[model samples]
Target: MRFSRILELGCILAGLFSGAAARPQDELVTENSSACKNPPKRVEWRQLSTTQRKQYLDAVLCLTKKNATSGITGAVNRFDDHQAVHSSQTPSIHWVGHFILWHRYFVATYEKALRTECGYTGGQPYWDWSLDAQPANLSSTKAYSTAIFDPTTGFGGNGDYMQPSVEQNPLNITGNTGGGCVKTGPFIPSAFTVNYPTPDCLRRDFIPWIINSFADPKLVANVLAQKDYTSFARAIENVPSFDQPNIHGSGHFGIGGVLGTIGSAAESPGDPLFYLHHANLDRILWTWQQKDLQTRLNQVGGPITPFDYSGKNVTLDFQINMGRLAGNATLKNLLNTTGGTLCYTY
Candidate 1:
């Protein structure tokens, strides 16, 4: 599993160097008297009250029944558009300088879809993996608690041991821990279905060792301390050697099985947790930006093309398409949460 996963990551990284590559308030409510008015709050998953969690979950489930316009042949609901968007543009967006900006727009668009299509009122929430990455209490973090895994309020726990195994990649990391469908949680096949029309359940196989080892406080501190975008992006997306420690990939690797799809170059959005993971990622970047907001806001680098041998800066006008999920948006417009259509903070 180690070698295969590492090799898979190497390909992603090679495509990246390649490209390149935060937390804030519980409720990020910012009102600018000079420019814009009130901005909504994007809270933490743990911070959400039971009621808020239910509301959010209900709306998320509701998206499954809503139709999609992304043009992916088998798409079933609005949620499918998101998955389709991620799948279609995965190559250009991932491991590129546009990874952050493109995903920022993608996440924000999903939030907008929730509100517009499902009548959801609250802003999107993020998961803070660092809180659970502590050494002493790593085994019992809230990330694996009933609060997060309960069938009623949580997304559900790992897949049942009897479920079919995930197809092994070429390197043969031998799929994740659990292979069967998710038997517990609101996402059980009997209770809910994914918009992308998968026959399997929402499986998860939490790899405690990954989080305990790679996602430690020290690693988080190292990533946070990076001075420039290049080193910072490379550190987080650490390719070349998948064995190298990286805080960004920790969450994805920590939750293996179907949930591990986040590690897939594409098709990651199929997992509902993708947004939360990316939201937290955005928060980290936002925190880094806060250290030098004036300069960081305008800072951009990395390769224009995934396979570029020569390092080149990503342009502001880089185009990203989302089909009917949302209109095409440029990397520049997606850069600032405060400027352009984006108004909320982490």
Candidate 2:
């Protein structure tokens, strides 16, 4: 067999037998040793030139017009698949070790859908909240007030709060300050409607307090600095030591209004911000993976399953389900975005 083929086989075997017994650390393949591979340049949202950003948005808009692949009856358009997939798998993927890998897969495939289906030429852009998490400028961060939120040039600011309180579980959380349809953005109902017909807007209640307190740059750095995967994942998701919400959750709250759909966790994908937020998360993971390439790439942490939902114990070999949007996927295949079926970098 070719060396690349051999390495691929090794990854599969390692994932399969990982839980049964310990394997030599040096035995696992690090990355594909392909001689010629094109690296994908995934830039930050802010770094994108006006044309690039518009192209990216145009592609996203294009996707909203495509038919859904999730097979859910009544579901329409590719964008709907995002909400459908996330809703069905919410129980198994969130609040677990698989959080990172599962989301990585979700965002990657979504990006792929954009390129293949909608002819998006650029890689997905990420929202690095840390840059905007500065104490002195929390209230004025460009993340919410700048071009990214421009009604014509950006996704638009908060929702218009046209409807009553939306009921999000765990807490009957009210929609953000606006709580209505997005009155100022490109995704307004007249221009583009959601999969399901709803009177509510794409709401967002920008909570500077949450961004300052939970999504702090220092806190995010500390979360990334953890030497082990479990600690890292927990800090981003649970942050047991602090009374504040998890860093990941903080981003949702920060952009939430009618965008509160993002706060829903399961329905967050309903909002376009979900991909940008997750791309940022994926960038963090990619950055961490680059530190000690071999070990970090193969390192799988936390339970294979969600702690609150299914009781199944996760093994390193666990296969992540992507619903009808993707074929069989595994952590091994997802570990290195530049390897295997993945070939992009941030």
Candidate 3:
């Protein structure tokens, strides 16, 4: 089937769950009482037992698969069915809205799965980044009631760059800074050289607060259940990005990029932080939705066109469904943010 036709069917499914009939794709969505809330109690990562961590990972993987499949299918179905009559003039207000809705559902679904499937009792936690700016000794990972990092036992080591400066000597001969160059001296290093290259080249010499700190685990559940846009926006704005780039060409490398990368190490995704980082990004987008209801309805600031890795442009009409890339999902089913039979609370 054509992409557009598939998306049309998906949209129909999404709308059916959302309690809305086929209508303009750009319509403003009415806030559902169950979709937003306050932050929840935080939980520390170190506090979690191995079993708990494994269960959380399992739940996250399942939820991601489910949403990705549904989202892609819906997108493809919508595109295939609406190709002929759809026009460029049609407003694209639903981009962010759809993004937000699906993401919230994504997080909530995982939280639910964790609770129901694996007997998870703790809530989702938030990592705070601002705390990393403090002085070394004074910086306590335990400052937040829900701190995820324990400074005393954290992995990055004690020193600022995790240890003494490698650039202390140029010609020490024991180490090289870069480009296969070695120097020997008790020399005051030039602008580019380092005596201890290993420490110098290390990323996360001092771990950031977000990775180390934790927020109330209930935050995800609360946000999903209430409509407090103020806190929601704050949380969204605070998500941190690492140094490495991903297939998407955005985000940080080691810390933030870790989860998103896929494939082997020689040419691997280049980071383990990718998935977790995107999950946080998705959370922020969801927060933006409740904060900016008007703009979402108007299709303001949506992507002009979807692009592939080679920079080729792809049309995003109602007919462009998700099934092509993500199996049986379609676009039509994703139009409405609420009204699905399986509703989730943060």
Kindly report which residue pairs in candidate 1 clash with one another.
Answer: 1-173, 16-19, 22-283, 22-284, 163-180
lDDT of 2 at 224: 76
Q: How far does residue 154 in candidate 1 sit from its true spot (Å)? A: 1.6
Q: Tens digits of per-residue lDDT for model 2 on 14-131?
A: 2332233222321343355362166567888889988888888888889888877767544578887776666555655666888888899789889989888999878889887777
Residue range 1-346, candidate 1, lDDT tens digits: 3323433433443332222111122113222223323555788888899999999888888888877776665567788778765665555665567777777778888988887789888888888777767556645444566365667786777765433334443433323455445677677778665544344455566666566555677776777798977556655666623356577667666675333444454445766887887888887777887898776766766676653527776766665655555555556555568663566677
Q: Is candidate 1 or candidate 3 better by lDDT?
A: 1
Lowest-sum lDDT 10-residue window in model 1: 18-27
TM-score, cand. 2 vs. native: 0.82
Question: Compared with the true structure, what per-residue lDDT tens digits does model 3 show for residues 1-346?
Answer: 1112224433444432332233333233233424433323324345456565555544433332232222322222211111111111112212222333333333334344445545556655323322232324323433322222222222111122222233422212111112211121111122111111011211221223323322223334444443443233333322322221111112222122121111111111111122233345454444445566554323312232321113321122332222112211122322223423123212
Q: For this target, which candidate reaches the highest lDDT against the unseen true structure?
A: 2
Count of clashes, each model: 5, 18, 86
TM-score per prediction, in order, is 0.82, 0.82, 0.34
Residue 66 lDDT in candidate 1: 77
Which residue runs does candidate 2 get wrong by more than 4 Å? 1-36, 134-143, 161-176, 196-200, 239-242, 257-259, 308-313
Q: After superposition, how far is residue 98 of candidate 3 from its true place, in Å?
A: 7.0
Task: For candidate 1, give the lDDT of residue 119.
Answer: 88
